[model samples]
Every structure is written in structure tokens, then in C-alpha cells.
Target chain A: MKETLKLFKIGGGVLDDDAQLHRFVQAFAQVPGRKILVHGGGKGASQMLSDLGIAPQMVQGRRITDAATLDVVTMFYAGKTNKQLVALLQASGVNALGLSGADGNVIRAVKRPVKDIDYGFVGDLPANSVDAATLHTLIQAELTPVLCAITHDGHGQLLNTNADTIASTVARALAGRYEVELHYCFEKNGVLLDVNDDNSVIPQIVPAQYQQLKADGVIAAGMIPKLDNAFAALEAGVEKVVIEHALNINEPIKTVLCRS
Target chain B: MKETLKLFKIGGGVLDDDAQLHRFVQAFAQVPGRKILVHGGGKGASQMLSDLGIAPQMVQGRRITDAATLDVVTMFYAGKTNKQLVALLQASGVNALGLSGADGNVIRAVKRPVKDIDYGFVGDLPANSVDAATLHTLIQAELTPVLCAITHDGHGQLLNTNADTIASTVARALAGRYEVELHYCFEKNGVLLDVNDDNSVIPQIVPAQYQQLKADGVIAAGMIPKLDNAFAALEAGVEKVVIEHALNINEPIKTVLCRS
Candidate 1:
């Protein structure tokens, strides 16, 4: 029997607010079993960049990561936010160790190819990005790893990566060894049946029903990509995927996606 | 027989210079057996503080770590400097992991109490600061830990600490499990016999010779505290302490302190 591992990913919404972040931390500490936390870059990086007089570079409504942007984000996400989270978790009695993808060469990414727009210092995860063996070793040693959204090319370049991609990739990679449960924690309660209604969280989601909901246009356009990604993770051997509010992780209200 | 572990400490001089830092990383990679690197904060943090409009807090000719200063230093040391070193080491085929004292609860420190001068967020490491068992686990797993001088009180406050103290404390803590060699790497070749001559390196110094050198004023006053700290580590069961140039670590002509 494989031991279960819960991997939770929280984004800017929870990270940017101190009270929410602390509440989430307190709730996260109560989660039992082997777990991992993958966090997204908050507004702090953009603020720092603005403070440092660096202008944001955008192409066709998409933000481009230049060298200066990468440095600030790396310092903000990997340094301040990650270390602070680790310290907070430690204070709550969790043996947490923070990591950037560069640490232990754990997640080696490749610079995105210049096709349409040149996204400077941005990385895309290849098939074999996450090092599962190293992660398993850490998990077995009773340490919860807090990973930041910065990865490195094997040849010494730190690249900005997507936190959601990191979470799924790590989940897929660790599936073979552990029954992996990937949780996406955000502001919303779950995949809401009524977009305006907070309590209309669909308790369960399977692939077939998800397709029907998409066909009926009941699922929001914004949620399709996330659901598709969740199903893909399920296809890639992850046992379960949960969508919940960052502050309500230990609570029962959530959307559970499973392989039927 | 205990396995040999080489712990190297490098300060601002090498870190502030890109070429020198890379050279030290290359030399450090070539060293065999289990090794760890501890680094101090460079001028980058101070520059960032100035750029961010945070003034230096000073108390009677000594720099004080105010809350703002602590935050900036933590980000710079534990974030930028530490991650860059880890990436560089990974590029050189060394599996490196970056750490703040809060990571893995590796080194829990106490915030310095208000004395004549209340140094706001500075931390002082107690005797039981470094967690040797966790370090041993990391070393045995073939991961080279690159530690920055940011530690935390167990109560969740991140504290700015002295890197030299961190190195010696870690070395002393791990001496029982490994035959530890603590190397203090700096700009000069070694401890100089004539303070004026750069090449006047002292090859070896025992306790009696150190006392005599101190009495005769042959040892420069600036080097006394560092040397005293080195000798104390020797007495605390560390097998050896080497004082050498950061770039010339692979070369000879360095001072070695030993217990006779």
C-alpha cells in the first residue's frame, strides 16, 4: 500500500493578505500526513519592482519576464515569502524546509522557446522536471517541503515558472511512489455551480460529468483550463485533486476530483 | 571511523565580487567528501536598503538591525545570495540545498535581549543552536547545504545573525558525528606575521604560540577575535580549523590552528 501525500498550492490572493495567510497557515498546520506546499508569487514582487524603478514589460496583454523582473521575483518568492512561510510553519510545529527548484536540482526547467514573443528568463517544465526520488526521501524523513515558483536550468540560469504547473508536475511525478492528492487552494470555495453563489460548490467532480458541464456551459470559461489540468493530473496517475479555499483546507467544504 | 566533513565559511569580500564568488564556488566544488558552505551578507543588502529609502540604524558606532533592516537582509542573504550560490554549485555538479536557520528548524536562535543597546531584530545563537541530526541526514543524502545568516526564534520571528558564529556553532555541533574541518575563507592569504606584507602567512599556530603572538602584538588586533573563535572551535572537538584565502582554497600556504 502506498502512503498518501497531500500537496497544496496557494496563490497570490492568500499570500498577499497577512490575516488570511496566517489563518491559512494555522489551518494548514492541522493537516495530517506527509504533505508539500507550493506557493505562487504574490504582489510583493511587483511592488518591489515598482519600488526599484523597474517597469513591467507586457506583450499582447501577457507579462514578459525580463532579467530584472526575474531577479526581483526570485528574491521575493524564493527568499522572503518562502522563508517566512517556513518559519511560520515551524512555529506551528511543522518540520518545514523551504526550497527553490535550484535547491537539490529538484526541478530543472528549460527556457521557453522563442516562438511568437520572446519571454525573457521564463521557463517551461519538460516531462521529467521534478525529481521524485529526492522529494520522496525528504517526505520519508518527516520534512514538509515548501517550494517556491523559481526553477533553474541545469546550466545555472534561474527561470520564472508558473506555480500551478509546478504543483501538478510535482504531483504527477510523486504519484508512482505515493497516493498523491493535489489541492489547489484559492479565494473561491470551489468550482461553483453558480458563479455568484459562494456556497454552490459542487461536492464532487469526475471526468465525464466535467465534460457534460463544459458542454452545457455551466462551468465558467476561466475554470475550464484549471479543470482540464486537474483531469490531466488524474490521467497522469495522481489519486485525487481538491479545490478549496486556502483558509478552509481542514474544513469539509471542497470539490474533490477523482479517477472514476 | 567518522567520515570527514569540511565546512567552509566565506564573508562579504568574495560575495560582493562576482568573479571571486564564482572562483570560490569552482574551487569548493573540486573538494572531495561531504562539505557545507556558510556565507555572510554582502553590500547588496545595504544597497537595497538605501535604494528602498531605509536608513541605517546605528548605535554607538555599531550597526543596529532595525525591523526594516532585518527584512531586507533576510531577503538578500537567504534569498538572492543563497539561491545564486546553490544554482552555481548545481551548475558545477554539486547537489546543493539553500537554507535559513528556520528551514528544518536547523538552527533556532533567541532574539538578543535589550542590553546597553537594544539591537532590534538581531539573534544570538545559544549553545544548542544547530541541529546536528538533521544536518547529518542532509549530508548523508549527498546534498550540500548552503546556509545564509538568517535564523529565527522558535516563536516565528526571523532574526539576523552573524555568519561567523553560525559556522563555528555548526562546526562545534557536528564534531561528534564527523571529523570536522572548519575553514574561514577571506581576502588575505592567511594570518600575517607582518601585517604589512600580504605574503607573510603563518603556516601553523598552536595555543602557546597564539598566546605569545598576542602578547608580542605580532598578530593584528583585527585578526584576534576571529583567531580566538577558531581556537575555541579546536578545543570544542573540531578536528582542524583553516584560515585561508577564498580564491586560493585549493592551493596551500594557509594558517592551520590545532589543539596540541
Candidate 2:
């Protein structure tokens, strides 16, 4: 197979619905090359968790997973989300394994906060500690690595993070990692022109307009940071940044947040 | 209010299934006492785990949790399952929080094996190293304790132990520490004569009958061990062990596994 695209960043929406998540995973397994799927939880996990009386806090758009929240987030996002993705790939005849940040020194980071704000444990990756080589070995064995969006900061703490950040960083960590296509799968059709209207799909977004949409308040409620993520991922050396629907990932919008 | 039960053992089944899990937890909350819930996975966890290509391993009827299995198991059984149960309880107007065997020295164990078979890092409680007093203060602040069925040996290794075993041990650690009432929740009716036939519910079985059933294969396979657990719990000084449906745990198994 031609050098495989190494990273796929799936949004929280895609991870929420079991059926959609299973399908997205199946597509990745069919594609030729090494691939890792990184996902987050949409309102499905957040709302239920909130309804359960726990408010989710975020620092720099990543979840601040406290001890109480870590328990829920790990179960919902790490175990349930990660394992289910692996299951779908497996069911589709793909060899895959579900893992956490603690599996084999896979991903490490240091908890980061907004200085004065108390957003529990969110992390910034350690200096070049992500060993994508070992992951490649696993990939060589034909096993797809389904990793959760969490990191261990080495100082006796685990950190909740953005799946987009995790996926793109993993891509940057490997040599020739740039060939990996960074895909952001969500419930909608990429970033929309008018965020107030779900049906007004943008079809494409550039770095400049993405910021403009945020300034206009149309994207502020939800879609802003996610698109910024798609932007940041491209900035971090991913070959292509694709924003698409989980139901129909075959048709992706060219939301290039950066110039290659 | 009466002094609350010191340690609550949360069954994993109660964690994943929120609807059923919430009702049962609320009943405990209304008991006018401090309490803790130690939980395990319902069928969702085990099935999902197998989905990730991690086969279930057991020796002497206890989980032989390996590293690969342990990583996923910790996230699933302890991390995820424990949190969901607490969240559900807290959502249903119960101030619930989760604690694991690894958290704050709550559960201590060693990398133990079953009958000298080397079981990797499955936690143990030994005589008693758990500090229930610290947990008591949290409950006194109106928080419900939800625990995972994991513990550490004196070493830093995480251990994989049976939820029943975890529950029993935690209860024992709390026997004289606090006035504790222990309940065992599962999907099926309390110990049956033949699991193949649910109507063959034993209703009541004395030690001699239990022993005879084990010899006669009537209480064979998994049943004998479960009954043994019930007996062991009684001997360890738990006021009572009720094997009831997790959904409606208000009524316990009156058959009572204890001395007359």
C-alpha cells in the first residue's frame, strides 16, 4: 500500500451515536494504510453528565477532567468510545485495539490550566515523548490503534484533551507523518456559513473566514473552536484537513484552516 | 439520621444502565445514613470489552486480569463503570462521587494470582490498609461514595479482582469501622439451583446443602463460587448480603447466606 495516512481526528458528535461511530470506523479500516481514529463526546456524554449534576469545564477548548469527571469521562469517552470504535473496525474485518494514554507510554503530557481558572487536569504534550514508532509497529501487525483523548502528564495525573489535538500531534510525531490525512468527522456537513442555521452548510472554509465566523457570533455557540481545531491540525503538518459528516464521510468539505 | 453504611460496593451493571441504576441508588440515599457504592460492569462492559478483542480470563472463578486486559479493564470496570454509577445517583438528586482502589489509598492490594497461578496486578485488601475514615468525612458532607472493584497490592501495581471479592473485602474493612449493610446486585435472581432453569430458584440453602450442592453439581460451575462469596461475606461480619435485582434493590434476598 502507498504510504498510509496516519491520523484521523473524529469529532465528539460522531462518537456519540453508536451506529454512526461504527460506520465511520469501518470506512477507515477499508482504506489502505496505517490509521488512528481520535474522537470526543458530543452532548450525548456531556448532557447526560451535566444532567447528572456535574458541570464539564474546559480550558483552551479541552476538557478539564477532575477526579469525579475523570471517572465519567474515562468510562464514557475512553472505554466506551474507544472500545466501540475498535469493535466496529473489528466487526468490519479490521484488526484493531482500544487503548488509553497509559497504554505503553503511548501519549504523555503535563496538565495545563488557564492559570487562575480551575479547570482540573487538561494537558499539553511533553517534549517529543509521543512514540509513534511503536504505534507503527502495531499498525504493521495490521492492528488499527483506537486511542482515547486523554494524556498522562507523568507527574501522577491524567489529563483530558481535545481529540483533534491528539490526532494531529500523533501525525506530527512520526517521520513522513505529514502524509496522514487529518479528518474531523462530526454530525453536520463541516463548518457552516451561518452557524445559527444547521442546514446552511458552508461546503468549504478558509482560515480567515473561520475566524470571521467566530467574530460574527454565528459560530461562537459550538462550531467555532471545532473548526479552529481543523485549522490548527492543518497548521501542525497534516497533509489534508477534512471536515465531513459521519454518516457520509465519503463526501468531505475542504475546510483547509491552513495552506499546505 | 442513623450512621451511614461505611463502604458501598457498586456493581458494574448498575453503572452502564442509568435508568435502572438511578432508582436503586436513590433508595440507598433515602436510608438516612452515610453510604458508599462499589460498582462493577453490567453486560455492556464485558460485551464491549470482548468487542475490543480482549477475552475474559478467570482463574478459580476470579478475573485473571492481564496488562492489556488490565488497561482496558481499569478504564471500563473501575474508571468508567464507577463514574457512571455515581453520576446517575448524583443526577437523580443524590450527591454521589466515585473512588477507585487506586485513589487516595482507598483500596490496597498486590499483583496476586489465584492459587499461585500469577494473575498479574489484580488488587488485594489483605487484612486492612484502607482508610475508611477519610471517605467517611466526604459522605458526612452529603456525598455518596461510588467505588470501583479494583485495589492495589502494597506495591504500586493495579490489581484485577472480582467485584464480589472487592465488595466483600471493602465491607470487611468497614465491619467495626462503621455500621455497614452490604447488598449484592446482579442481573439474575439470587443463587439458583440450576442457572439453566431460572424457576429452579433455591429460595434458601444451608451450609450443608450448599456443600452438598457443590459436590452434586447442583450448585456447580459459577453458582458454587457465588454462593461461597455470599457465605464468606457473612462470615466476614457484613450485617447482610442481599442478592437482588439492581433495578429494584429495595427488597433483598431473604434466603440469607448466614448461620441460624
Candidate 3:
């Protein structure tokens, strides 16, 4: 039996608010066993860009990560937010080591190939992108890696990547050595039965039930892609995937997705 | 017999200029041995602060690292500059891993105590600040750690430290395990005999010679503190302390300080 490794991802909602971010860090520190925290870029980067007279370019609803934008976001996510989170976790007695994918060549990504629209400096993860062996060494050394949503192409390019994709890829890659638990933590309690009802969280979700939930229109449209990625990770040998509130990670009132 | 470890430090002049920084990284990647790079904050951080409308506050001669300044410097040093250097080094075939002292608890520092003046958010490293054992492991792993001058109080506060101090402390700490060589790379070719003559480079300087040169006013007044620190490291068992030009590491025109 392999040791349990919990991987938690926190998105922009919790990251944008200082009070909420501190609360989440406190809760995350309390999570027992070896763990890693993957954080998404918050509104801070965009705000900095606008403040610096740089207008964000978007096409077909997807933001374009140009050269200037990549520089700002890299500073914000990998620099300010990542170091702050690591400091806070350290204050709470957690031995957290912050990382950008470029740090140890831990996650080498490819620049998203231009198709209909050019995504400037955005990166996409391919097979064998995550360096699981190095991560295993860091974890076995008792360091919790706090990863930001920034990676690099091996040949000198730092590319911005989606945090969710990074989390799932890392979990799947590490599954060979550990029982991986991928947690998606956000504002909501769990996968909701009704979008308006905060208390309508389903306790557990399986792939079969997840398919039925999608057919019945119970799951939100925005959440479908996340769940699809989660299920795909489960298929790829990740032991479990959980969706819960960032603040309520230690609680039981959450949704767990299993292979069943 | 212990293996040799080369620790190089680059300050503001090289770091502020992109072309110069690239040249330095290229030269650094070619250095053959276990190595580490320590980088100082450039004018970019202050430029960002000024661009964002934060006037820098100076107490006496030293700049105060207020909360806002700390944030910008952290992002600039750890985020933009560190990652850029890492990417560039990786491109040049060096396995460079960027780190703030907070990462891996590699260097823990104490907040500069309030004395005649309070330098807010500034850190001063004391004895045993650098975790040499962990660094040894990282070097043994064939990873060149690219360190920024950002550290944390083990209790959670991220503090801005002097890059030169960080390099010296790291070199001294690792002295017991390796034949450590500390290199301070700047704009000049080396310690010069004539202030106006770049070609009058002192190829070597021993402690007795350094004292006589200082007595005769051959060394510039500004180079005193840096040379003092360099000699101090030589005293602390670091095998050699080299004062060289950032872009001329591969060349032989530099000063080497020795115990003899």
C-alpha cells in the first residue's frame, strides 16, 4: 500500500481576498499527511496590468497572455502570492516550499500551439510533463510544495498554464508512487443539486452518477469541464478526487469522486 | 576529500541590464561543478514601485523596506528576475532551480531588530542561517539553485535581505562540506590599481596585500566593505573568493583572494 498524498487546488476566489486566503492557508496547514497546494492566479495580476496602462486582450472569451501580461502574472502568481502563501503556511508550522514548474524542471510545458487564435505565451501540458520523481524526493524530505500556475518550456520560455490542468496532471503523474487525492477547493460546499441552494451539495459522486447528474442538468455549466478532468484523472489511476469549500477542507460535508 | 562548490553572486548592474544578465547566465551555465547563483535586486523593483506611485522611503542612508516595497521587491526578485534567470540558465543547459530563502527553509533569518532606526521587513541572518545539509543534497542532485534575496522569518514573515550577505552566509555555511569558492561578479574587471584604468586589474590579493593596499589607498573607498566581507569568508574556510566581471567569468582577468 502506498502512502496517501493529498493535492489541493485553490482558485482565484479565495486568493483575491486576504482574509479568505489566510483562512484557507490555516485550514490547509491542518490537513494531515503529505500534501501539495496548487494555486490559481487571482485578479491581482489583471489589476496590476490595468493600473500600468496595459489593456487585457481577449478573443472569443479567452484572455490572450501576451509578453507583457506574462511578465506581470509571473510576478504576481509565482512571486507575490506564492511566497506569501508559503510564508503564511510556514507561520502555521507547515514546511511549505513554493515552486514554479521551472524550478526543478518539475513541469515542463509546451506553448499552446496557435490554431484559430494565437494564445501568445500560454502553455499546455503534454504526456510526461510532470517530473514525478523529483516531486517524490521533495515530499519524502517532508516539504509541502506550494505550486503556482506558471511553468516553463525546457528551452528558456516561461509560459502561463491553467491551475486546474496543472493540479490534475501532477496528481495523475504521482499516482504511480502514492495514493493520490486531488481536491478542488472553491467557494461552494460541493457539487450542488440546485445552483441557488447552498445546502444542496451531493455527498459523493461516481463517474456513472456524474454522467446522470450532467444529463439531469443538476451540475452547473462552468463546473462540467472541471468534473470531466477529475473523472479523467480517476480513470488514469488517481485514487480519489474531492470538491469542497477551501475553508472547509477538514470537514466531511463535501463531494468525493471515486472510480466506482 | 570534499567536492568543490562554486557560488556566484551578481548585483544590480548586471541584473538591471537584460543583455548583460543574459551574458552572465550564459557564462554561469558553462561553469563546471556543483554551483549556486545568488542575485541582487535590480532597479526594476524600485521602478515598479515608482510606476505604481509608491515613493521610496529612506532612513538616513538605508532604504526602508516598508510593506509595499517588500511586496514589489518580492515579486520582482523572486518572481520576474529569478524565474527569468532560471529559464535562461535552463536554456543554456544548466539545471537551475530558483528559490527564495522561504522555499525549503533553505535560509531562515531574523527580522532586523529596532535599534537607532527601524528597517521594516528587513532581515539579518545570524549563525546557522543557511541549511547546508539540504543544500548539499540539492547540489548532489545536480540542481543549481538560483537564489533571490528574499527570506522568511521561520515564524512566517518574508523579509528582504542583502544579496551579498546571503551569498557570504551561504558560502560560509557550506564550507564544512565543500571546497567552497565565492565569486562576486560586478561591472569592473577586478580590483584595480588605478581608479580610471580597467586594464590595471589585480590578478590576486592576499590578506597581507589587501591590508597594505588599503593602507596605501590603492583600493577604492567603495570597495572596502565588499572586500572586507570577501576576506571574512576566506577566513571562515571558504577556499577562494573571486572578484570578477559578470560577463568575463570565462576569462582570466580577475582578482582571486586567497588565505596565503
- TM-score to true structure, per model: 0.99, 0.48, 0.98
Tens digits of per-residue lDDT for model 2, B45-77: 576557556778887775666776766676676
State the lDDT of candidate 3 residue by residue for A1-260, as single tens digits.
89999999998889999999889988998899999999998899989999878899898988899999999999999999999999889888888888999988899999999999999999999999999988888898888999999999999899999999999999999999999999999999999999999899999899899999999888999999999999999999999999999989999989999998
Ten residues in a row with the worst lDDT in model 2 chain A? A251-260
- Arranged by DockQ with the best first, the candidates are 1, 3, 2
- Give DockQ for candidates 1 onward, in order: 0.85, 0.05, 0.80
Angstrom error of the Cα, residue A7, model 3: value is 0.5
lDDT of 1 by residue, B1-260 (tens): 99999999999889999999889999999999999999999899999999999999999888999988887898899889998999999999999999999999999999999989899898899999999899889889999999999999988889999999999999999999999999999989999999899989999999999999999999999999999999999999999999999999999989999997
On a 0 to 100 scale, what is the lDDT of residue A151 in model 2? 62
Scoring only the second chain, what is candidate 3's TM-score? 0.98
Identify the leading candidate in terms of DockQ: 1
* Tens-place lDDT digits, model 1, residues A151-202: 9998889999999999999999999999999999999989999999999999
- State the lDDT at B174 in candidate 1: 96
Better of 2 and 3 by DockQ: 3
* Candidate 1 vs 2: which has more DockQ: 1
Candidate 1, after superposition: displacement of residue B245 in Å? 0.4
